[model samples]
Target: MKPRTLVIGDIHGGLKALKQVLARAEVTAQDTLIFLGDYVDGWGESAQVIQFLIELEQKQTCIFIKGNHDLWCEDWLKEHILDKTWLFHGGQSTLKSYESLNDAEHALHLNFFERMRLYYVDEQNRLFVHAGFTSMHGPAQEFHQSNFKWDRTLWEMALTMHKHITKDSKLYPKRLLLFKEIFIGHTPTLNYDVTIPMNGCNVWNVDTGAAFTGSLTIMDIDTKEFWQSDTLVSLYPNEKGRNR
Candidate 1:
């Protein structure tokens, strides 16, 4: 029997790079294509990025987790976030992707970004998250909106102080938070290789910062193989400090 596996990680709104990574994975019906999120707000083609995932959703088992960037897209559509700020941060190209749409059509475009999940996991020995968990076996509840979605302070604390637990976190406090590898995005790798803790919570980060100088990457879970696409030229540089 062919081994079943899952491929996932951050896309950061680059449709072309996403496609190339899928091609490299040689995705098959037996395999699942999962995304860790950040569906919009970087590179060109937010509409195209959403459309691509939507189409893929039809033929394969896909799970789209929401990321901070995605939340910004939803906020932008609702005008909850200022357009100039949104567009300034790699969102201009995303806006351009839907420039031709009428109001009704635009609402449809808006819907995609609005509906997304925050986390996903299973007994299959895998879990996925946009950033990282709260603390050493920190409650998954810490990832709840009240924790990171709406509270910047908590989010920053998690980011600045959190460490990938090698053994257990509150989220998996009792079960040992097991994973031969936990694949993730949100944090750009120092170079190109995925960072894994020497003892536990081995991480495979495929987000090669495709929205900037990084390559779009995806990994084959069962084979320990990875596929990457070259950097798409940055349309919005100096979005600075904030992650894509």
Candidate 2:
């Protein structure tokens, strides 16, 4: 019975911030880490973030779910979406993530990313979705394959279907809500606090929009304890050299 349920919010490529937060969180071998998606885009170190995640998965019980950003990445790679948008949204960082890898290694990562699940569930707790789903489907995990995978509409609909309670807040709070606490990202917080009020329901917005700021946050699901880091990092060699 591990006491800590470390759930990381949307990273958005800020590897240095994420690293500092992880260190402050003091992850241990006994601790299980659940990653909410959107690990790429909008930061300087998308490649490092992905590679770190891959390594962590090998060493620990890391459960991850997909975000819309991830889907878009796949779509772009598959020619379903424009690559320029991906590049513009820090996709270059992701591309650079494979700079040291050979062709085979890059392809392996591509395959791994492609096979990522949209959401995950346990008998006691569900995990690691970049955004949540709402549907007539009985359980949260019971969403249809296509509906669950790339359908933001399905997730939004499920929130309404749950009939969760909500209210208008200072930050555009007219949205609907949900019953279950779906760990999510995508929508950013105004102050970059790593918390967003999407529908004011059980859903928790964890992206914190680090691409615009330096704070990357993680919440302990079991205890609702939150942690963050604001370390700065530069991506380009020139930037690094100048800072040094």
- Candidate number achieving the greatest lDDT relative to the actual structure: 2
lDDT of each: 0.60, 0.60
Off by over 4 Å in 2: 1-3, 75-82, 125-128, 138-180, 191-199, 231-244
Q: In angstroms, how far off is 124's CA in candidate 1? A: 2.2
Cα lDDT for residue 13, model 1?
A: 66
Best by TM-score: 1
Q: Write the per-residue lDDT of candidate 2 for residues 1-244, one digit (tens) a residue.
A: 4547788877776777778778988877778887777777666566667778888788778887777667666675555456776666666666655567776765655665786777776556543456544454423544454444344543354345445433444432222322235566655553434243333345566656565643577777767777877633333322221010
* Candidate 1: tens digits of C-alpha lDDT, residues 91-192: 776667777767876677577666676666756666666665643454264645523222223223333333644244454333234444455666656343
